[model samples]
Target: MFPADFAYVRARTLDEALDLLDEAHAADQEAKLIAGGQSLLPMMKLRLAAPQVLIDIADLPELRRGGWMSSVVGGSFGGSIGALSTYRQLGRDALLNGGVIRGRNENVAPHRAEGVPAITDVLTVLADPQVRARGTIGGAVAHGDPASDLPAVLLALNAVLTIASRKGRHPESHLGPYTPRRTRKEPLNIGKREIALDDFLQGIYTTDLADDEIITHIRISHQGGTASAYEKFPHPASHLPLAGVAVVLTYKGGRLTDSNGHVTDLADGSLASAAIAVTGISPRPYRARAAEALLKDAFPTQETLAAAAAQVTTESPGSANRVSLLGDQHASADYRAHLAEVLTRRALAKAIARGGRSL
Candidate 1:
């Protein structure tokens, strides 16, 4: 199964890639950007996508860097992940693994009680080692694959994506209605737009990315007294999740106590907030707002947790619109919904436990 004939352009830099994409658009030619090629290549091979141009940006150094930052945008301190970062890199990142926070004022990094467990957990199960090694987080999210694990994790984390485009380079400088001027030597006048992870994903294989835009970074905040975990039931053959849930819990005053009820970790005892996101059960991953609202400031007892988990469907109370559950040969809609609840319970329990409590 060979792909259709296309012109392959290996871009040396981000600007070059953007230029090529712009040219393709101006000419009305179908073009696709290639990073890790883990997602796009397979679709091309199957003849599902046959773009006339394949622009490779894998070698662009700017997209490969990943690190912690004091502020990614609007004075929010968190981790800034380069779009080209692979699952292998994310899985091994110390900053994401847990409690180490890099302070903006000083070079010294402080250790915390917990790191981001949900990300590492998802990375471990997101396919075999080979696929994980080559799959870029940006590519997976940009492709808008509902079955992919990372999008749901991002949703639970309340992550933000930085989308870049060459919008301001033209001499008109109107920032409104302007045409791009072609100049090989002129540096790219890059503009950025930040979108919430939940808003960025529209539906199956769809995103908010414009034709000339590319995802530049993913930003996730690390708050004190918060922990996250991911759980999934994956298909045996493809390893894509049949139902996956990512839970992030923020507890304000809960002390890590011993079996005798003695405070072990020296903390408070109040649940502040909870966020749950589920994937692989619908056309797109979505935040379980009803479930989250139920758990907010509520003790995560077995009964309450079960009640919250039951609200995993998009049809939960206060939902804006109804979303149909996706059914396939592998799993029926009823069963998939059931798995969503089960996995949500498991994920919430694990996340709460990581916050030093058990239900």
Candidate 2:
């Protein structure tokens, strides 16, 4: 099947893309932005999305750059990836794939970010090589697919988004207007703000993106002593996760004696903070806060991990039998919940090992 007839317009600049979107909204015409066209094109061909106009921003230079910068004075390490950055670029980037440098300085202290392993793990099995080459991170995020691999990882990292638009150019965003997560220098000439990935994602195939706005970049940050990993059970054919889990553990000052009488250096060798997120088993990917609460500040023992993992089902925390799970031919809701539990345990173990210490 072919996508319905639509007018195609290539945008040479970020402002031009916004202007195109603003015009479409003013005329009450359906317009969609296309970057790599990896997700949208498939939906269009299936008649699930039929925009009357397609705005091409694939060639915009501002949205194609990907790099990271560290702030030692602030005691924070972070970076941003452009909206047009493809999965292939992200997977191959040294800095993104565990090359992150953290802590004060090399002479005084050095550390690795806890967030890199999850990014590397997801990118490795996200899809086939062709899709990784063409699928942009921004597009995958903006598409808001519940089965997406990256969103779960991003959610676990508490990622932030930088958006560009002129105020009042489009109707209010579904999740409301943008709110800055922190203070940052803006472009001045254009309206810009940052949003948390948690707030940015509203539902399946839905997001907080305004019709007249464009996602400029995705920002990620991590404290010095954190460890994170991602695990997924992919479908045999489509390669989408039957259930995917991402876990991030933040450790702080302490030492622990292992079963072998060897001392391990950690923040007490226990989890100071833990974030667990699950995808591909519900209407939306969500942080397993209830499960996280169970593991936070505790030793990641086999018994403790199993107990926390069991709390990762689609059932709402504090509610009995109130659950919503995705049921399809590939897997039933019960099966997905089981997979979520299994993956959570695996992700936790992998993250702990990556932290270079055992509980």
Candidate 3:
């Protein structure tokens, strides 16, 4: 199948892309932005989406910047990632891999909360080399595919997204006399709005992004004494996650000592916080808050972990009508829900073991 005939425009600058989008919206024309074209191209070829104009922003210098930057927000030091960064770049970057923990008190142990193993772990098995080479982090996220690995990982990290858009252009604007007033062509100083990653994903193939907006950057906090890991069960053919789980644990106090003077117990003061996010099971990826609450302030034993893992399916308690599972040709709802519990337990165990001592 071939897509409908469409006009193509390549944007040289970020502002130019914004202006093009604004014009398309004002004229009441369907326009889509293309970066990496990994997701959009397939949809277009299948005739699922046929836009009047395709605005290519792949060459925009602003979106192409990739590197770690020192970020301090609300007295917490962390890192910011440019949205246009490719998966390959993130996987190979030494800073993103396990490296020196920066912006922390010297007294803190380096192994506790080191680098972003959660991200690197996902990248290692995300897709094949070809896809990783061309796929951009921003594109995968903006597509809002429920099966994508990064969304769940980012949610577990409590990451924040910076969306870029201008105030004058509205997606609902039309070209008639009732058309909204257009502002003068000013320099492309995109107005940025920060949204939490969990809130950003509204549903399957849906997001909080306005039609005219684009994701500009992502920010993640790097708390000391935090350990995180990602695990997934991929579809045999596509390698997309059938069920994926990310776990982040923050530890406090000294190592735990058992009754016999052995230091293998994970007792009360061992874990400070726990964050778990799961994907590829329901209509959308979600944080297992109910399950998280069960694990908090408790000993991380096999029994306790099993109790919490069971809660992964009961996203909300006392709601008999809630449909927490999603069924498809690949797997039944019951099977996926079971997989979620199993994967969550495995991920939690690995994360706890990793967080027990420095990487």
By lDDT, who's the top model here?
2
Model 2 misses residue 123 by how many Å? 0.9
| lDDT of each residue in 67-134, candidate 3, tens digit only | 45533331224666778888998886655676554456766444422467888889998988888888
- TM-score ranking from best candidate downward: 2, 1, 3
Q: Model 2, stretches more than 4 Å misplaced?
A: 71-76, 100-115, 168-189, 254-266, 314-323
State TM-scores per candidate.
0.85, 0.86, 0.83
- Candidate 2 or 1, higher lDDT: 2
Provide the RMSD of all predictions against the true structure, rounded to 1 decimal.
6.5, 5.1, 7.3
Give Cα distance to truth, residue 147, candidate 1, Å: 0.7
- Clashing pairs in model 2, backbone N/Cα/C closer than 3 A: 252-267, 253-267, 254-268
Against the reference, the lDDT scores of all candidates come to 0.81, 0.82, 0.76
Candidate ranking under lDDT, highest first, comes to: 2, 1, 3
- Candidate 1 ranges with C-alpha deviation above 4 Å: 70-77, 99-113, 168-188, 254-268, 319-322
Compared with the true structure, what per-residue lDDT tens digits does model 1 show for residues 254-282?
34877888876534444688889999989
Which residue segments of model 3 deviate by more than 4 Å?
66-77, 99-113, 168-189, 254-269, 317-323, 357-359
